[model samples]
Target: MFKRIFNNQQPISLKWKWGILLFVTLTLFGFFSSLIYQQNALNIQLNQIQANHQYFFEAAINYLESMDEPIQRTHFQSVLDEANNNDLNNTHDSTLEFLTYFESNDIVYRFFNEKQQLVYETQHINLNPVEYSDSLKRMDVNNQMALVGSTKIISENTGESVGSFQYIVMPQLFDDIKSQMQNNLYVILIGIILFALAISFLLIRLFLRPLTYLVNSLDLVEAESLSQLRVRKPRSTDEWSDLSDHINRLLDKIDNYVKHQKQFVEDVSHELRTPVAIVEGHLTMLNRWGKEDPEILEESISASLQEITRMKGLVQEMLDLMRADHVDIDYKDEITEVYSTIRQVFNNFVMLYPEFQFYLDIESDPDELYVKVFRNHFEQIFIILLDNAVKYSTDRKEIHVALSTSVTAIRVAVQDFGEGMSVEDKDRVFGRFYRVDKARSRDKGGNGLGLSIAQQLVKSYRGEIWADSVLHHGSIFYVEFPILSDTRQIYKSKQIAKHKSL
Candidate 1:
């Protein structure tokens, strides 16, 4: 039974668990508290019995010493009657409690001469002989717990022992008080445990209500409803509300990723279909009749090989796109100086297109501008823009490259006097497999993924990329990255280590 209740896999409700814990804790506390209270109460009663017994012993001894006759039982009775009447008539409330043992036979005493002959005693109880002590001792007498004390009676005149006095106080009032307290303690503990359990259950449920709602909301979410479903946030600004917000944000990302995956598959399939069909047509022609004629066979084989090359290039670019999506993870803690990389790529481009006019502009402090990007990937961003500029240039054949900086960012611009784009094309130029002029783009050997790859790479580095163009006039593509500062010198150190490893 204990194993089942505590099993981790088959967990119980938090409210009941807390309730049980509180119940046990409070029960133990109440039990110990009752024990302490009962002990104190019994001690107080015992002390009072001892004090009254001492008073009687002294009074009886004084009465015997005052007499000119020998001590007798009658003299002790007179002392007891006088003590009772005196306590009854006392106006002070303090002395009134002395009447319980004084007025009744509940307190019995025995007096013996120094030779051990009994001189006086009450007949109700026969207490066994006990050694004399300063404090009263509790012991069983006649099957009842009693306060017992023995003391020597001394003569005031000579300071000599005349007799010995012993007392056995049943203290029925003390016994009755103990019994009542025991019963009351049991009732109080049971009531306290029950009340504590109830309160704990209520409090636990109240505190966990938000979590319960969150769990229920999560249960309702299905893959199909991800885009439309949202967890309801609590009104209070607490950890539970923060949790709801995080879950909602996570769902949004999942929905977007699913949509992007679907679009990526569709775009790849559509792009592949045309080339696949071209290859298929050529193969079918060669098998049917083109194989018989050398010219036709050569033409079919050339077209098929060209299409196959294009397909291979498409596959390679798709792989690059995939890598661009994970650039942050693949190239973590990478940093580069802006000027050196730009100069190198520009010089290469100038050498490749020596006939075309090229211009370089540097508006920022090139030595000071640094950004967080792998040197190779950083160079790739500019290469794509420059190559696009070269591919789409008009008769002017002039390209411009500029490096500048803002307070927070390093900016690079690549401008070309090319066959520019319409507004619709400009808006969608960074979309996967998009092109303004499809036939012209294919004729120029453009797969339309260059700008998309650049965009993804820039976004992965927490940067931005965009283009502005006028139809038939020209286009300017811009890239921006946040510059690293003194506080982030750690990245530079990391870059040094990375280069050493390489």
Candidate 2:
């Protein structure tokens, strides 16, 4: 499970982001280290000098004391050489070595005693300085000058003067000093680079995370629907939030456009075909008989007239349907006389197809049985359903239409014992231009817009239409509309025009 969760499809950006982070970290560390190295080097040199001052002072004093004691020249020279070299041969160095170690960077040596001056002064001269002045200055209480009294010439072993001994010290730059500093700075720089890279990688990951989420989310999605492509968003006040909003808006526009395109096609087909059929139908009828045959001409003319009628109905229904879609109807709604409307529509349907059996069950009086509806809308609804029943009935079969009241609304059910529709056909029956028996509908001369227009008109008055059917069994269409009271004033308004006509 963990392996699957961390799949091997890491984004290219993640690697590059982390790489840049490392580079910046290393650069920063290097910069700081270089800064400290120069300072630390100066401090180290200062420490060395302070330490040398103490050691060198002791070494100078010891050389002065040795010269003060008279000693044999050769024997004294050997002891002075040991002190100057700072290399005592015992397990530990002697006190002389510790004293002379201060002058290790320069030269330190002890000469033969001053009493042996006869030969030594002629043979040896110490390095550095114009001279180790025989009268070097010292301070008195009144700042008066005096000779450095301890450095005076002395005897050898017999306490006779040989010569004066001197100790010299100088400063030298250590050969590896710069190299050590450079090495320290180099390690610091590397460490800085690594640290910077880590931080930079993290920042890049954070900045691009929303975009990456959108991309990875798309990868995981396995769908073509608009809803499926929606990505979860980050909760940050940043540019990423703006981008997410834009993406969602784009998807919404795409979905709306697709829906409109489908509707446009359906509307165009429903609107255009009826007129085209009328024209072609008339032309075909004339071509078949050429106006010479009277009977054929009558039949052709009648057929053309029927087509024209159907086309006119299609145009009117189109206008009504569009209005219903785009505008709210403001006409009055009330507990209309649903039974009377059914009786009237059923009579018209049977008059048009008298061979068919039609019956109604209006179980309530007009006052008690009202469906809140616009009269024109109910009329159209009644016509469309009855027309469909008559058209689809194969054996001129019976139609069962019943009107009843529910607690909140009225239901007017019309059942046709005809060549019934399939479950699929019933589902989309109200969609524009959808026809189950296309051949029959076309021959009967309909543009396939009646049921859709009826549905739209019904909904304009806040009603519902649905159908139930099996393949072989007959179909039943149920239309439910609102019920309303306060009919006394409405009855007076309805009777005014009728009374005037009478």
Candidate 3:
């Protein structure tokens, strides 16, 4: 039954739910409060009635006790009858006057003889006398409830017991007061429920306004319109505002990623088109005349092979660039000595370019200069820099490799007296497929992907790499990496030595 009333298919709104909860709570509180008030008020009135009964009983007993002789039951009966008749005659009223007097006074007197036989009771049309009991009790009189208090009448002169007297009170006045209080409480409960419902609705709307705006803004975002989409700032500087700011930042990152991806596709297609076209031309020549002519066949096959090799190198470098983004994840535990890696690359370059002079300088201990990086990648980055230095140098015919240490990082620099780049070229030298001198780069088999890959790898290791160059004098490429702590280096060396022994 409860589920049917509060069905999930048509769930109650937050505003209505809160309002109903508060209303029910207040209703229960008001009901209990009213019940307590009624109980206390009735108790107070009952206490006052009891006190009045005690006073009247004492007054009647005192009047009888002051008699000169022992009072008989007949004398008490005559006293009560005479008092009722005199009061009625003085008011110039009938039996109705006597009834009204007893009702207003809220008490009725009754007297019994010593033998407990016949007694005197206030005259009333619906009066019903009951057999006396020891304790105070309620009795039914004319279909109405009455509280009865009784006491024995004693003669002080004879020290003997006389008849008993009782006072009966109706509690109709207290009942009326309780009924009025219940009615007032009902009216107050209804008013509070209506007010709570209205306020709850208004508060819910106010609190949810920002959320509604966020939903609407999200709906406006589509693939085609992502770059143009923006979320509006809320007026309040609260958690809602902070949420909107974070969402906007996420949107900006996604927009940049999408743009870069599209550009990457276009650049790849352009770069491959020339090599593919050259290969096609060679195949066509071979198919037409090179098959019959030995010289033509030889030249065509050589040209095709060169273009295929260039395309293969280009694709490999592109893969390297893509992989650089996640290099840290792949080689997080790999550590290498910076001086050793640079020394290895320098030695290989010297062997390959025997005519050029290679100089090296190491100012830090090799073991203490350890960095978090893959060994092969560390060698590759320096090799790319040295290769570029060799290709671009015009006058000096000499290369300088330097490794130094700071408090926090290891710095490696490769300086060459090369044909240095202009300010504009320096800014874009790290872009994929960008070259300062296209003819020279092509002749040296440069695909312009080396420096870009080096930069990305350096970034993955939380390092920085940049070039300092002038237009004609020289260029120096510097890379800095945060050095591993001495404790870590020593621990890693011990672990490596342990594994080798095993």
Candidate 4:
């Protein structure tokens, strides 16, 4: 039954959790405070009672010592009566002064002879004999708690033993005060606790208002409204305000992502439609009448094959683009030697295009430059740049490759004497499926994804890649990667240790 009431599936709210926490804290504080207050008040009352008992016991002793030998009950009774009648006279008589205390207070005074026989007692309450002590001893008198004090008196002149002096104080007044204090304390504490709980809840709601507003705004956000959706910023300079700023930035990214996704879909469809239409047209013409004529049939088959091959290349490039975006995840720990990879790719390009003038300049050592990049990805970046350089060359079929090293980075620049682009084209050259001259790009079999893939790979390795081009002049592509020292030995040792552990 308890489990059903507090079901885990329907968990508690944050506000209630805060309230419960505050309640427990306040309750514990009040409990400890009450205990401390009660103890302190009791100690104070006990001390006051002991001081009064001592004062009265001493006074009674002094009065009894002034009397002659063989004291009688009449002595105490007569002296007490006189002390009561002259209590307001301000007389200095010891008997009167000592006995005057019995007027307004309830105290049992008893005097015993040297033989331990009781001589005089003010109250008839039965209190047991207490041992001589400066502090009061506790005992029961007439079904009520009382403090008892006793002492054997001695003569100051002859040093002879006098009768024993004893006093029993009920302390019912202290008990009454304590009971009243306890009741009052309980009432005040309960009232304060209730008022504190109310204030705590109000403060909790005030502090959490921003969170509630954010949640409400988020609840209204859907896919269709993402482009226009933005969470309002909080006014306070606290974590809530920072959270609001972060959430707003996230929404902005989501909006851009959605827009980019829509654009990419449209671009892919437009690129695929042309080749599909060409192939479909060729097949349709062949099916209708071109099948009977070998010339028409061969022409249609050739055109169809070309369009299919182009479509296949387009599909492969699209796959490569997708893979490039996630290279960091698949090859996070890869390390590649920069000098070797660049030289290898540059040599391969040099051989592939013998007609073009390819110059390779190495300003760094043969194998000193290393960077945090997969060898394959490092090679691909240069391949794209070199290929573009060769394909776009106009009057001057020359390409210069330079490798340089700095204290922090390894830099590679590929310069092509090609018919370059305008300022606008250079700025957007790395965008997916973006071409400055679409007709020329298609003729060169460029799907416009090569530079985009290069950029993605470079960014994945925390490197930078960019191009500088002048209209009708030439273009230079630069790639820079942070330098790594002694990475080869470290990587080798990690591999050895990993295999041993396995």
- What's the lDDT for all of these models? 0.79, 0.64, 0.77, 0.80
Write candidate 4's Cα lDDT for 1-502 as tens digits.
3474477766677877787787778777876787788779878877787788778777767766665554556666767666568654666655555655554456767788888889887666566667786556776766767778887777666677777778777667667877987897788688768866887788788978898998887887864488777777777788998999999999898887788778878988999999999999989998898899999999988988988888888888888877887888887767777777887998898789889888989875753556878788899999999998987899899999998888899889999988899999999999889987899889989888899889989988899999999988889999999887766655774585468569
Residue 427 lDDT (model 1)? 98
Q: Which residue pairs in candidate 1 collide?
A: none
Rank all candidate structures by their TM-score, best first, as comma-separated numbers.
Answer: 4, 1, 3, 2
> What digit string (tens of lDDT, one per residue) describes model 2 on residues 1-502?
3454368465445546466665656676668666776668756874574455445544455444444344345554554577457555542423344343543433334444444242222123233222344322232312322112124344333454545554433223332454566677677767676667666677777777787888876675455666557766678867888888887788777777677558867777766776678668777878876578888778777877776787677778677777666324455423356777778888888788778888988767654465556556678888989888887777648898888887788888889878888878888888777788888777886667788878877776778888898776778888888766557746764675357559
* Candidate with maximal lDDT: 4
Best of the two (2, 4) by TM-score: 4
Weakest 10 consecutive residues, lDDT, candidate 2?
141-150
Q: In model 1, state the lDDT of residue 288.
A: 89
Q: Which model, 1 or 2, shows the larger TM-score?
A: 1
TM-score of 1: 0.75
TM-score of 4: 0.86
Candidate 2, 468: how far from true, in Å?
1.0
TM-score, per-candidate, Cα-based: 0.75, 0.44, 0.69, 0.86
Off by over 4 Å in 3: 1-200, 332-334, 486-502
Q: Please, what are the lDDT tens digits per residue for candidate 1 over residues 1-502?
A: 4687767667786666776787677778877877788688767866776687667755544554543333455665555665567754543332123333344556666677777667766645666678986456778876777777776766667767777767667757567767887887788778877877777678778778887887777787754377888888888999988999999999898888888778989998999999999999999999988888999899989999999999999999899898998889977777877898999999999999987899999985544467888888899899999999998997989999998888889899999998999999999999889988889889988898888889999999999999999999999999999988865575565767678899
Point out the higher-scoring one by lDDT: 1 or 3: 1
The most accurate candidate by TM-score is 4
